[model samples]
Target: MHVGVLGAGIVGLATAWQLSRRGFQVSVVDRAEPGSGASGGNGAQLSYSYVQPLADPSIWKQLPKLLLSPSSPLKLRPQLDPLQWRWGLAFLAACNARTSRQTTAQLLTLAAESRAAFEAMLAALEPDCDFSATGKLVLYGSASSLEAAGRQLELQRAMGSEQRLVTPEECIAIEPALAAYRRQIAGAIHTPSECAADCLKLCVALEGALRARGVRFLLDCEVQGFDRHHGRDGRVRAVLTSAGDLEADAFVMALGTASHRLGRRLGAYLPVYPLKGYSITVDVDPASEGAPHVSVTDSARKVVFARIGSRLRVAGMAELVGHDASIPATRIETLAAATRAVFPQASRMAALHPWTGMRPATPTGVPIIGRLPRAPRNMLFNTGHGALGFTLAFGSAERVAAQLAS
Candidate 1:
């Protein structure tokens, strides 16, 4: 069987790889180069044990700051588009203890599977992408929130996650670079099994490896629509692209934010929406300075810090501003400033590689994986991963390929 995977980000590349491994002739299609989307400059933390949904009951109380504060990490620019309003309402509806915990449970299972799958691939491919199993520390600013996180951690622990709440001094012991910022931390949840890697480099490596394994890549080929057959169980025979109609036996859509528009064309209502995010990569001296070897997440600031090779990948902020991909100077500045405040000696603040991308997010934070009843039988989707694209890609890819195989 021949399979066509849409989008060349981490998700698409992983899907192509899994299909190829399953003895299917695979081809990947993307408008631009691989990892040019959110995969390029994401926070490099592979949050396996710390899979928290964005839509929590706490968002209800933080609504005022999120709406009024200029320095708030979460921004919502209400557009005239009805999709925005609809998504917002759905997001608000999902902000409950029951929904958040349900989503978290599913994500934890997928994350564990992803960690194993990625490690197996790592041993097989032996690809160098600055991968590290350094633990993750999510620092909370207030004791009440820390207590709340502890309660959540208990639930996660019930779901086979190994994590513990730690004091500021203990966090410093884990990552000495966090000593400077220790005063701001009230407490933290430490996950020792967490890992980090350069996502962009990993994507490039996967693309090359898949190509070597006879998986074709249709780069620079813009997918216009799908060429489908008739009936409820109709199969999408091929993808109508700028290059030509690339025929395949099965099709999987992993087109991130663009997934929604293209899905609508196939009569599939994908709940994927773009949450614009900013990231700044800065050159760092790990040995000479206090650059962290471990990944850190500031719960209060909503920013993350990870050392990817000699560069510090600092990313955060979630903005609901449509499909605008332009990197605003102020947004980059805010990210840089946050990095400076958190890890002053980590990197040179002036020399920052600023990037902005549309992170495809579902309201509930649980990715839409596998085939939908309303969609074609041979058609599958791996969209709405939100910020956890790199974290969940392999597991989701495995699931998608299983559907095709069965």
Candidate 2:
């Protein structure tokens, strides 16, 4: 079978790799290079315990504050776009306790399944992506915050995540670099089985592996539309790309944020919106204090820290209602400030590379992974993962492949 996978982000790459491994002739098309989108510049967290949905009943109280505070983790740029208003309403609707609990359950299931698939892929490919299963520690700034997270931790634990609450002293013991904040650290949730990796490196390695496996890549090719031919059975024939028309027995839409546009063209109105995020990577001098080994997420600040080799990556913040990819100075400064507050010993923070990318977010946290109900039978979707793209890539890919095979 010939399969055309759209988008070259981690999700797209993983789907293509899995499909190719299943003996399908796969051709991946992307306007940009591999991992150039959200997959490249994320927090790089493979945290299976982070299954909580973004919408919480408590968030309603914080929304006014978030809207007022420019440095707040959640920011909504004032815009006249009707889609933005619709999305905001949908987000508010998902903030109910019942919806949040249901979403959390779905996310936890996908996270665990994805973690297993990722381990299997790593064992098979042996990609040098700085993969580490050293676990992740989520820290709260105040005892009240920790108390709140404790309930979430219990929910995660009940859902089969190896997560446990730890004291400030135990947190510092597990991650010695957090010693400076020991006094301020209220408590922590340590997920022992969670992992982290260099997402960019992994995508590059996977692309190379796919090439070696005879998977064709149509780089710099923009997909204009699909070449629809109504057969006697009323099935669409092939995808028409910018290069030319290519026949594929099956097609997968792993286009990340761009999936919405393609879905609309294919008569499927996906509720995926582009949520922008920022990150800064600083090189850690070996002569100075080494970078963090285990990834850390600051629940108070909503920032995540991952040490990729000798570089420390800090990523967080969500800006809705803007397609502008330009890096905002305020966002970068906020991330840098959070990093200094957490890991004060890390040196060379002045010189850092800042980047911004859009997360393909749905109103509900659960991504769309099933076959398009209205589209041709061969067309499948594996998009709208939002901030969890790196965390859920492999499992989503496996599911997409399974759907295609069925």
Candidate 3:
């Protein structure tokens, strides 16, 4: 079978790899290089314990404060667009206790499967991407926040996560560099089974591995639109691109934020919106203290710190209702400030490289990974992952492959 996988992000590449391994002749298409989107610049943490949805029942009360505070983790720039308002309403509707629990349960299942799939991929490829199982630390600066996190940790533990609470001293023992902040540190939760990896290096290695496996890559080719050729049996035949037409027995739409636009063209209405996120990578100076080996997420600041070799990356903050990808100075400053607060030993702030990427967010914080409702029988979708693309890519690809084979 000839399969055309649209988009070259982590999800799309993983799908292509799985399909090719299944003996399908796969052709992957993307306008940019592989993993150049949110997959490249994200915090690189494979947090299996982070299954909670972004909109909790209590989040509605905190929304006004989060919007008013400049330094707060969540911020929404008011827009007059009706789409934004509709999405907001939908988001609020999903923030109830029942929906939150259901969403978290579904995420836990996907994340666990994803972790296993990632381990299998690593064992097969042996890619040198600095992959580590050092676990993730969630830190809190205030006692109240720590108390709330403790409750959340209990919920995660109930969901089969191997997470535990740690004292300030234990936190420092795990990562001694955090000793300086002992006075300010209240507590933390350590998920020892979680992992981290150099995402960019992994993407590059996967691209090379796919090529070695004879998977065709059509990079720098923009997909203008899809050409629906209905056969006598009323089945779609081919996809028309700017380069040329390609005949495919099957097709998968894994185009992250662009899925909405492409789905619209294909007569499918996907509720995927662009949630912009920013990150900064600081170059570690040889003379200064080295970066933290473990990944860390600050609950209060809503930022994550991931050590990728000699570079320390800090990423967070969700800006909804914007198509712009420009790096805002204020956002960068907030990330830098959070990084400094967490790791005071890091220096050379001016040497930081800042970037922003759009997350294809669904109002319910769950990815849409199923066959299109009214599209051709063989066409599928694996998009709207938002913030969990890298975390859930492998598992999603496996599911899509299974669906196609079945």
Maximum-lDDT candidate: 1
Question: CA lDDT of 151 in candidate 2?
Answer: 85
lDDT of each: 0.90, 0.85, 0.83
Model number with the top TM-score? 1
Q: In model 1, what are the clashing residue pairs, if there are any?
A: none
For 1-406, candidate 3 gives per-residue lDDT tens digits of 8889998998998898788778888999888899898888888888887766886887888888766876667777778866667777888899888888788888889998888888889988999787888888888889888887777777778989888989989988887767766787789898877788878788889899999999988888887777666774334466677778767888898988888888877678778888889999887666866467778887878888887777888999888846888887999998888778778886577676889999888888889997876666677899988888889999899999889888
At residue 390, candidate 2 shows an lDDT of 92
Task: Give stretches of model 2 more than 4 Å off.
Answer: 231-234
**Residue-wise C-alpha lDDT for candidate 1, range 1-406, written one tens digit per residue:** 8888999999999888888888999989999999998899999889999998999999999898877877789988888988888999999999999999999999999998898888888998887789988889999999999999999999999999999999999999999888889889999999999999998999999988998999888999999988888766667888999999999888899999999899888778888899988898888964556788889999988999988888899999999889988887888888888887888888756588888888999999999999887888788999999999999999999999888888
Model 2, global lDDT: 0.85
lDDT of 3 at 72: 64
TM-score of each: 0.98, 0.96, 0.95
Whole-model alpha-carbon lDDT for candidate 1 = 0.90
